[model samples]
Target: MTVLNEPATLLNGSAWTSHVFLGEWTPGSGGDYAVVEPATGKELARLGSATPGDVGRATARAVDAQRAWAAAGYQERAAVLRRAGALWEEHAAEIEEWIVREAGSVPPKAALEVRTAAQECYEAAALASHPVGEVLRSEQPRLSYSQRVPAGVVGVIAPFNFPLILAIRSVAPALALGNAVVLKPDPRTAVCGGVAIARIFEAAGLPAGLLSVLPGGADAGEALITDPAVRIIAFTGSTRAGRAVARLAGEHLKRVHLELGGNSALIVMADVDVARAASAGAFGSFTHQGQICMATGRHLVDRRIADDYVAALAERANRLPVGDPSGGQVALGPIIDVRQRDNVHRLVTASVDAGARLAAGGTYEDLFYRPTVLADVPLEAPAYAEEVFGPVAPVVAFDTADEAVALAADSEYGLSLGILSGDGLKALELAGRIPSGAVHINDQTVSDEAVIPFGGTGLSGNGSRMGGIAHNLEAYTETRWVTAQSELPEYPY
Candidate 1:
């Protein structure tokens, strides 16, 4: 293993000779691509993009490694993961810095990502020794039981936003369940998501070839998905890409888990604290430049207090500091790239053209877009109708509870929703009416905990849960029933 004295230097414009891992860092036969820092458009490194052949070789290695990994038993697996989790905490500073530099994550958001990743590792470790089988009673058989077995190799394709944590959320669970994984992280945050994770696991004494990190674009993901050795695909990205993965994996009859895009809504009821709800809306809509899948895309406020809520939200949005992530003073950092920035601006401009009044911000300085608030946005506007994954919040007024529920349920994506109301029972009632995978009461839409079933419905996902124990049991395992007869009865013909 190549150990650097100052591992933080890896984040600075260092050239990587390999991207595919098979027991070690193996050079890719494909072309190299530059890893551009989204915050500054500077070249952090040039990483080799894996070709189809490279992915196949990695999959074969994983297939071989999975057998011994499964037989290693849960106790051994738990030890390795616990060590990996400790390593993650030890290198928290560097990992946080990498997230900010590569993915343009703000300081606090980056730190949270690191913290969450480490916590996921720890959480996954606990699953290693947990009971994975159940006793069964049969009518005729002497003994009957069902056992949960690993799904062999799992393919993990993670997105740039919250890359490390998202990847860890999938990878750790698969590993803990005794499945070898080949991860293809988003090319944008390859170092933080790929290299950093590989090193940590390798140092923690995980068997070589058990886990591989390949940093590439769509080609690598397609290669992993199509490989026969891969039994399951755990994907977190846009709905378009998730659909493609689902379709392809279906052809092979392989299991797939997707956590896709969401246009979550934050509904402020008439009896709630308008200022607090506005603050929650602002944070939900603009945190991490609003790149989160569960970030609030629409603010549906009661018409009676709509104006007051809009004013409070606008004040908070305008007061937020926006600049380079390295400055350590900014709450909002740059968008992922020029295209993303342009796409966000286009949506905002189109909403304004459709008669939405911009109340706070509608401007950009370089890649850093100011937190924007638009009030009285029509339902048909792109900001309200689609996933405008930028630091923009479009507020729409609703007259009644039914109208609020209708507005929230009008989206094709049903990942998450936030309801703010003084009455807990009312919020609970409304949460039940919304058809989303997760509903937050008295809180913002953008919330994730490792212990919860994290996934989505409809276009948001394929209904395969990630995080939590249920996801671990479902995504990484297959059930097998075993029956034994103490005495064989005479064959009746």
Candidate 2:
């Protein structure tokens, strides 16, 4: 383990210890909120909270700054983004410590988050040099083309789980495409998500007021979405919250992108190695305490090998170490907070009462919950039906491929799906039948890359992806048709 550094020191040794980073660190009007360490239930720091008025002020400044940012040359923008990426990598260790302490992530997960965030910046930097649009044929004897233009100010609201990656996925691309951003990060993980991002960009030579970090509550989030200056909204969180955001953004006629909740499934075939498949299942369901949106919520196993698979998964679950991440190395860390822990426990208890066999664990010590495995989980079981969002794996047996497909497709969420089989073609064939944003063949549900298009279908998202050059351009910019002719076009007057 490495020595942990204070966030204020890690943030470029500035006096930005305040909560809100709106151009500069200023005391917010929403009063102060305690930044708590979930692992120890201790107060890590006290920071000012942003109110709705602060959100408005941030948006106003962003709007003013966006014009100049958009006017800057592409190379200048790219340079800023590239420098930010280097800064993220340069401060990886310090950032990881903040994530572990503030976001309750284990060391490895924290490192992955930092790496992914850096990759996001690097990928976005490339977008600055990508072709903006296409030339089209016109019928009126004129040269016509369409070009991509910035969407002015973008409002980004991110969740606590995988905070840095989720927020940067949108922020970097938007900034690279010449759009200013007003961010509202979950107050629980604001230091890692909001302040860290602001520091990196500030050090990378981003002009002041182009990005604003508001560590705030729902009021601030709502204000960001409703602010007329914010023309685009990028939100990642639960489906319930997404619906509200979408509704409000729609009313304002603003373009919005959502990456919401998911109850994804992983299918296991009888032909593969039971232990190996079980290992994949455990990783899919237990990584970062299964708090990811793409976490495998339900396991659909072939009936022939269901029993063996369940035993193997339970064995893996039982051996996993659970404790505070900051204390030492542990396989699993504490849940985000008491409310989330109580919900996870409620779902587990209800599932057991509904006849699901508790194969391994169904207990916790404070916020540290043991990795749990439940076999013979009925379709109607609460844990199986809902998004557990915890270290709970519920297994259900399917007799045939058709039954497996049906079981896997039962959820309202179509975020991600996984298929495990010895035959590649068979797995590919099964994947085609499932309508998810991402399908992993012979792999787990939890996966992401900087260049890949990532989002979901149905309740998972709004059919808008956050990665890849084309997708990023589409999300952060709009297309405009322009025509050129030597002289004014002749028309019947």
Candidate 3:
């Protein structure tokens, strides 16, 4: 267990050393990969790439045990998930530490995820036990009932950002519905997510082959996706990668749920509190170094408020504490790697050269890029059109309601959008008109459960991961209607 040793050799869930070409965590195979400390140029863990063989074994294990698991009644499934939830609550501290270390998240942010996973487990357990379809009323003596059954074995491909939370969003629902999960975490930060799954499943007394985590990169993913035994695929990653999965899954006619890229916007109106709105908007765009899919990338402010709001936002950006992610006061940490830092720097430079104004930071020091805020940014600039997965937020001014809505909705990726306005009525109006999957009024966009339906219309993703009743229905469901007649007709047409 990870609680026993922080530097323990990474496990492939079921065993210690990897058995290559079969579901195992082989050390140094596909490519020599290293887990780096985001704040420092230090290597914490070295891993080998997951070969095709590893994927075959993992998929086989999940497929082998899927039928019996699906046969297990909802009551039994709920009971197991309840135990897993209790265990997750008990080991929150340990899980949080691993998450922060491997994923580069602040301790506080990581702790919340541990709590969130437990809550999702409980909610999924409740959802699993409840009957999905209802009885219908008819004139003829007939019976009708619908069942929401598991989609057989599920393959989860988790991302680096919010590993545990993102992983749990799908896995818990899969488990509660009595589906076996073969999770392939982001190779760079797999330990934390893998450990959490291992601990929860063990505590829940799940059958050995019912759940397993294989930490691998592309080769591993390709193997799993191609396997015919895998009935369902849940992926969270880039649009390019998501497209590949969609194509591959289409050929096989396998079910897939994708949560892909984002180039979201934040629109601030003239009536809002300039100072507070600027601060909130800056944080939303730059938080986690802007690596998250829901992170705000585009900024649209009313022309009357643009200049003053930009100044306030710059000042607020300067106030953010920068240092190690593990510290208490540090709100901003270094980017995940030098490659991302260089990419972000290039994006900022191109924006400035293309006529965007640098309102605040637009410089870099090694892995840390200063929190950048750009003004007078045009949609023509590359930064304006693409998803900038970094700390730079480009701002553009708008005068009319039509102009403001047009600027925010201009991006091809429509993941999430935030709005700030004093007039709640106007804010709601704007929210309704925005083209993205979710809209926030008088505040920055966040992954809220009860309030918004989080997702996108086009390049952002094909499906929503978490939200309200629709999300629950989408995750684990199959619809079929039955028509019955009490008086049987003897004549056949």
What number of backbone clashes does candidate 3 have, counting pairs of residues 3 or more apart or in separate chains? 2
Candidate 2 at residue 428, lDDT? Answer: 91
Q: Residue by residue across 314-370, what tens digits does model 3's lDDT show?
A: 887777776777665677777877777888888888988999988888887777778
TM-score of 3: 0.90
TM-scores for every candidate against the unseen true structure: 0.96, 0.97, 0.90
- Candidate 2 structure, TM-score to reference: 0.97
* Candidate 2, backbone clash total: 0
**Candidate 3 runs further than 4 Å off:** 1-33, 46-49, 136-141, 450-453, 463-470, 480-493
**Cα lDDT tens digits for candidate 1, 193-227:** 88888877877788888898888767778889999
TM-score winner between candidates 2 and 3: 2
- Model 2 worst lDDT run, 10 consecutive residues: 1-10
lDDT of each: 0.87, 0.91, 0.74
Q: Which pairs, if any, clash in model 1? A: none
Candidates ranked, most accurate by lDDT first: 2, 1, 3
Per-residue error (Å), model 1, residue 170: 0.6
True-vs-predicted CA distance for residue 3, candidate 3, Å: 17
Which residue pairs come into collision in candidate 3? 21-53, 22-53
